[model samples]
Target: MAAEAVPAPRREAWERRTTVPLVVLGVVFIVAYTIYVLAPWIPRGPGSLLFFALLAAWVVFVVDVIVRISLTPRGGRWAFVRTHPIDVLSAIVPLFRAFRVLALLRNVPYLQRRSGAAVRANIIIYGSTYAIVFVYFIALATLQAERNAPGATITTFGDAIWWAIVTIATVGYGDMYPVTAEGRFYAVFLMVGGVAIVGTASATIISYIGEKVSEVHARHGNSGSAASDQEKGPIIEPPGRAIQDAIDEAGAVDDEHGG
Candidate 1:
């Protein structure tokens, strides 16, 4: 028989339980991948070990995706896949697994707090972090891909870094550019990521400015109301301000009539 889908609550609980561990693994994977990319002189034995470790980490991520997919309700499995493109992509594409390091942001204490401001804060934090990491990795990967190729403009690490920055900013200045197929492939991703980061930052700034303007207007409106109240002199609240005030006013009226 086919496995039954787990309830949403249980799935969420599983996610929460797995987040930190996966983040830790992601960090390890990044470090290992970085070493694997930048260091090509290691002894065969150690290199093999590192290779297995990286493979193991990838397997874990793939298994995590499978488990989550299985837990999702049958009706919503497609929705889950649609919403979690990164997770799905990371599991399927080894090159994208580097992006998994982003999960580390969720473990930050300040971002973990539950507050109205936390959402925007998370966006800013994630977007900035994502851009930096993306730029660095793309630089390294592009350098690896282009360095040995004939007529490669981005032959050195510095050239690769410059190229990555310009490409990610969508500013292809032409001083440095990728010449290899793999390098060009990474350039495409960098451009897309750049557009996304720029858009997010722009939206966030506009949102914050709009909020500030509204707050200033609200404060001005409140102060104007207070000033108007003061200009009218004492706020001689109508006598029936409360039940007791009404009762006292009625008693005074009776006294005035000697009733």
Candidate 2:
């Protein structure tokens, strides 16, 4: 592989430096590709422009793979590609371009740090944002693929969004559906991502609840210890109290004897 010719250090440096720009490129590609898919009625010149944009994005994706392979510890390109099938498919299958959003995972921790949010709150916010974005993109893809297809029930963006929400929630209301295989694949992808998000959210909630319970238990334990100390009696201990009572009895007997 030509990429294998590149020095490992250089490849890693390039990846580190270009990671942000690559993410930006991926977003741009997604937008351009969406427009291309949805607006088939557009003129040839604009369509050509969108096509080139997609091609450029594909090139970047390919470069990323090669660089990753070059930097691989021992496995080389083929092994790396074999392990990450999604990466291989992302560019070759243009429909998988949306899969690039998985890159956002790298940024999630950074975002959480910048926002200074608790883990649970951050997870909820991130999950909600991700879910919304995912649903919207899936809807757009579905709309583009299914809109002009024969016997398609999803002609409008509204219908596409509704279908996406329903499908992702595992609620299969049969009012709308994709006619094309490409669109159906997107739906499957959406469902899988949705399930993953649900699972993550569940874990986050459980962890947060556990933390709260632990805090409460710890707090109660401290209070119980304090209560036990208080129960040991006043400033003077039990023996001191007994000695004071005996002194008072002796004084009372002396008074009676003096009377």
Candidate 3:
């Protein structure tokens, strides 16, 4: 039982140590990929450098996922996979290298230190970051896929980005659309991602607003109670004073009766 229990903690420790580093590497991957995609005419030397950088970051992500899975207890490996499908996909899927940045959601320093408002705020910020990163990469991928296809409407990077934005919002404006199979495939994922991002952002904002409103109400309630307490001051006399007054009245009644 002791040996069985050890792996879980070790795995948790490993994750905690690696989370920030992996997020940093994901940033490196995005930067390299962005340059590579946008500057197709760059000289071979710089291009190769970016390629290797992207590959290195991707290799690290793959290895991280493998290590995490190996550390998972045999009995719960399935659960780990089920719960961490995004991590698995980001590591395995070539295009999903961009999605590796989503790991930022796991252990952002600011988000980790607080709950409620702080967390909701971080979610909104990081969530927007993830969406922008996702759109950028998917746009590049779509551009590459559709660039050579006959009658492709998304030949340029700008058009690809526009299509991605509209598709993800489920607002296919009909002004830009994917023509090739690969582009359409990316489009499908982009659409789903858009819905998830928008939904999560909307929900987080609503929760933050609700929390603020509740806090306001709570402050008002406390102040109202304080005011009411002051207004209804001393509804009952102090026990000592009441006792003294009763004794004095009894003495007066006895004096009157005696007289």
Per-residue lDDT of 1-259 in model 2, one digit per residue for the tens? Answer: 6534434565568767877777788788878876775677664363487777777899988877776766675635565567578677776766556666556565555445643245556677667866887787789878988888989999988899899998888788888888899999898898898789879888987887888899899998887778865685666669889999999999999999999
- Backbone clashes in candidate 3 total 0
Per-candidate Cα lDDT values, in order, are: 0.81, 0.76, 0.80
lDDT of 3: 0.80
> Where does candidate 2 have its weakest 10-residue lDDT segment?
109-118
Clashing pairs in 3: none
Ranking by TM-score: 1, 3, 2
Once fitted onto the true fold, the runs of candidate 3 whose alpha carbons sit more than 4 angstroms away are 1-7, 16-21, 43-47, 102-109, 228-259
For candidate 1, lDDT tens digit of each residue in 1-259? Answer: 1323334776788888888888788888888777876776864254487887788888999999999889888877887887788899889765567777677677788898876478789988888887887888888888888888999888777888888887777788998888888888888888888899889999999988988899999998887777775575775676557777888999999999995
RMSD of 3: 10.8
Per-residue C-alpha lDDT of model 3 across residues 15-87, encoded as one tens digit per residue: 8899878878877877776777677786436348776787788788889889998988887676777777768
